[model samples]
Target: MSPDLPCIVFVRSFLHKPDNIDHTEHHVRQETPKQIDGHTHRRKHSSDSEKTLTVEDWATSRENPHNWPLAKRVITSLVVYIYTFVVYSGSSMFITAVPLVMQELHLSEQRAMLGLSIYVLGYGVGPLLWGPLSEIPRIGRSVVYFGTFVAFILVTIGAADVSNYSAFIFLRFMQGLFGSPCLANGGASMHDLYPESQFPYTLALWVAAAYCGPALGPLLTNSLVNNISWKWTMWLLACMSGPVCILLFLLPETYAPTIRYRSNAFNTSHNQNNNNTSSQDDNPLAKLKFYLVKPVQITLQDPAILFANIYTSFIYGTYYTFFDAFPIGYPPVYNVSTTTLSLFYLSVLVGCLLAVAAYFTYLSLPNYLRKHHDNTSPKSTPTHTPPTKHERHLIPAIPATFLVPISLFLYGWTLRPSIHWIVSIIGVTMYASAVFIILQCLSMYIPSIYPEYAASLFAANDFCRSTLAAGAVHFGIPLYKNLGMARGSSVLGGVSGLGVLGLLGIYYFGERLRAKSRFVERLVE
Candidate 1:
């Protein structure tokens, strides 16, 4: 072992060690370049395999909101309704502020009213954007809820701080733009929470909440306007918004496609490890493209959806017109203060409460009993199927449809100063009740008709209702002025009569229309 010999031994040991160069080179020498490349590829493949992960539903997974506990679904639904209540309340709360707004801003009555009308128009158009984003499996309901909710609050605050009428109008419009997701996506969220069987009842409560919010809004803001500045009314909205924003964050994602996407179970691509790159659009523009095109396509192609949009739009227009009509009739005839006038809006709320009660007793209980009976009945076949997959609950929408015309006529005739005010209020209540019933039926039925695209279907309905309501809000006041409450409301009543015919047309022919469309399918089993 001379020193040179020792150096040689150290070099051989370093180079030829089994864990280092020796075994690697031996394999390198044993194979051609292609074979060596193949061997290297196999090693790389084995390394990649360990990094790959699979997503599957476990037994009793909570990924599906339908499987969430009753408490979670109920709380979440209540939060969503509260969010809607705030949005709609914001829409009408400023009605009391219109006179103050005109006075302070030195604007005309028409321009002052545009604040509210434009806000509603924004709501109509907002769904054109938010509706599609929400349906994206990547974006989902929770994100829309949180994002829109925060935007609503900020816009409401901006509305309070704006000094100019134009800025005020812009902010109000932006407020509606941001606030509309709750209205547009709410029914779809309810659909996520419950199975098809439970949607009608839940949707009825939801629509009731939404209507009642607008009714209650004038009541709250009347005090704010009378006691505080009109700016405070906007501030009141901002204050109310804070808590809803918090709750929206707490809500679990209820959009099914989104949940499936997150769980990786929904994407059918073989390489989900690519982070759903193949299944979902990485570009915002691509997502927007689908969002914009699909709902319009659905609305244009589907007769049932188009009819529902038109039917609800008429009802919505009439409802907004009442905001002006009630104020006009009572202030001049009864000489009521704005605050007292706001109380008259309660007629609609009373009607809503009664309709809700009637629904629970007449529709909900019977449907539940029928369901239980069918499920337990010996007549149920060996397959244990329930009797019918179609929503027999919609049977009520038909008879209730006629009430709109009757109530409208009654509301018109009873509004004269010669008549007692309570009599007129009763007429309004009847109209409200009928409208509630028709709307609940439509909301529930439309979603059932297009379960796969419930959000888009709902967005279409929202767009129709809000756009018409925006036009009505501006034109409705003049209409009452031109025709007087009696003739104006009578004209509306006659229009409502047309709605009854439309409803009848839908009731008899709706199924045939739905069956022809490929975009939608029957909801139930």
Candidate 2:
């Protein structure tokens, strides 16, 4: 078995034995051979006559997620989408309540801001632990999803009732930590159910849910905070998550390795062999090291990946900073109440919806059909050929890179009493749309480039982005306070403009960078 693959083989002894048999019945362990350069090499077993199951067999089996009924897969996908939304909403749902929390706890603005920043930081850290555990066939994704969510509910309930500043902050971090699995693993779960051709569409919907969750958070809690109390925000999160937890119970295990393992265990029990049991490395400590250490190593060693992560972190930081920036930019200029300001977040949802529509209309569907026709067509040559398959994934990001700076500049300059607030909102919508495109492109493109490290790359991506966003939450208010809206936003816009260069460089030169990467070299070998 390849260590690169997230699978482990085990040997087990059956309890029951035939009365005439003096020897113990041992299960035959099958190791799916690794595929390199489009060729598969199978390992030789002790008994050539013994029936063996291969990875190809598992791929076509009814137990495989891709082989499941359409309705089952759709329902499962919906559950994951909603679960992600509920968890992501927790990060920003408390923004409107910061003032109330400050007043109630007798805290300063910076101290109160920890409620949001600390939670964001927790998301950055939780994935390092959860990402590895979910990859274990014995552990699986469903357990991670259900278990942490229950913990999230408990932490949220505690956060709602806590009065001490320290306890509230601690509970807030716990909320993010416990709620992060969906954010870290949601894409992988979707990948498990769909082929590459169809995955981008599902991922688009998933990304929309993720983006819209925080975007809609303030809107959902605005009325509650204005009418009742800030604590209701936490209570609302708990209430919304409770039913979703029940729905998760109906979600079958989607991780292919876990399903394969279970099926193998059943088969081994029924048909036992006297052949010596073969197994992969089963050391827990070694497994843990691979999961935790590999992602950081890959990110640092691969320049392309590192730059991509940095760009993503900047975009995410700007997005979270908006949570703080909106209050500063909107209320004073528009003379709007908190409730009215919350409505502006809808512009983000509008941007996300627009991006999704455009992705399907222009990119995902057309690319999928093109690939399908190429596969089925009689002629060996196709009319259209992209520069590179992976690079083609980044086409939308080209325009999006320029849009980031343009939108940021427009947003920064337009926040004046003389200017209509709708104009600034158009900037917000543009920024949101650009962010959605850039992130979605990177999310798909990065994994495609490094298929072996997809899970770890995602964990690293989440950690880097969330860590920056956490800092942004802290510094965002102060940036506006000291530099004022126009200057502070220009600073951010200027930083984003650098991403335009970085993205363009990556788009044109990414293949060369990959060819130089030590990690990529290892995969080639």
Candidate 3:
């Protein structure tokens, strides 16, 4: 719906009492302009206003996407998924371009890979803003999504054109800066659109779509860079944004409170009626402390609280560092073309698909337990035993730990120009798959345990992960070169393997561990 169109403007006015408010179709913009390269063209925005929607609001409101007509909810999920796909694509789109970047910029292989690192830097930092900033009911979601996109597309062009290394890295960071809101909020938006029962599975689908960008980006860019210059790869990637904005223009505001507040306000003013407090008398937000949560406070305080979770930070930071580490070590070891390099992107896909399948399996266990047992309330079922130290989800990180080093060692040691590329690919696949499972576990577990501040928690985690990835990309090549791929990978693999010990410890003692953190404990029960 065009912001100026009657339907778009009418929906923004109160649905129940449109006559009371101004009915004219006006495009009321929000904190951020909503448009980016993939899904929108946006202008910069600034604000921190948002309505607090509790878990109860999620269940009872027919306006919530979970309660909306099935078709409407599906469309909403797809809309979010599309934006994630594009933002992720932008990150890895330069995978095959490292060589071109090296030659064009008069840099070494080590420095050239910084092009990729610079983008990851963006992802790390973006969530701090995008997650909290989009909370406003008044600013509207479309404006937020679209506005950021416009800034993102422009920055991509700038990054491509910048001649100086410092300048190019700066623009790439800006691209990430603008593009990150889509990744950060898209998950929360999905939560808004679906119930907790369906959140894991639906989120799995969204993650899989997000994973597609890393897989497809390298493959697509490899082809583009092979036929032409790396510039075409970015140009083509940015150009794909045109249609996404067209679709976003029609997308409705799915955030329920925004819709409800507008509707109620319209009714109160239109017929000279009473406020929600006077009319409905059952407004949940009446008691909410709305004014104190300024944007700056949210940005600083929320992240500080989340950063206190060492496990979330360590895991996210470690995962992305090693993820990019794979490209740095294996790409040069095998001497493959940009196109062939994309084949290395499969490790995460294999692991991700398994994780996705595992997500459904986890969902099925509860259902199966319900069927076999005499169940009354959904919460009272006793078919399953409580999780034990050994029976933990985080345990998967153990095997993944070994794969990280072992695969890299194998790829590094075996990857001579004379060796077939398949051996190296096997190593990459193993590492990607391992990383994928851990990544999924970290994201899902945090939310599962701390549903209240899941969005903020994710942002804090991204801050750690992105910062580490940026560092790893810059430092990884040197380590691999000095130690050689086998030894370098072995060392990294060992550290990552050591990380597994932490996961195992958590799996075994997580309950006791959760008992230690007030934030975790308070949020859970």
The candidate maximizing lDDT is 2
Kindly indicate the candidate among 2 and 3 with the higher lDDT.
2
Ranked candidates (TM-score, high to low): 2, 1, 3
**Residue lDDT tens for model 1, 1-525:** 121111111111111111111111111110001111112201112233333223233112466666788999999999989988888888888889888887877888778888778888998888778765676566778999898888888889888998887888899999999998877677767766765456567878888888898899889888878887988879999999999999999999986556656776532332243342323333444445544555577788877677778888998888888878887788888788887899999889999999888876765455567667556634434433332333343556677778887887787778767888898888889888888887887766664555445454566677889989988987888888998878888888887787766766555556556667777553223
Query: Which regions of candidate 3 fall more than 4 Å away from where they truly are?
Result: 1-62, 161-165, 265-335, 366-420, 523-525
Q: By TM-score, who's the top model here? A: 2
lDDT of 2: 0.75
- The CA root-mean-square deviation of candidate 1, after full C-alpha superposition on the true structure, stands at 16.6
Distance from true location, Cα of 325 in model 1, Å: 0.7
Better of 1 and 3 by lDDT: 1
Over 115-147, each residue of candidate 2 has an lDDT whose tens digit, in order, gives 789988987888877776676666678999999
Question: Candidate 3, overall lDDT?
Answer: 0.57
TM-score of candidate 2 on Cα atoms, chains taken together: 0.85
TM-score of each: 0.80, 0.85, 0.72
Candidate 2 least-lDDT 10 residues = 10-19
Quantify all predictions' global Cα lDDT against the true fold. 0.70, 0.75, 0.57
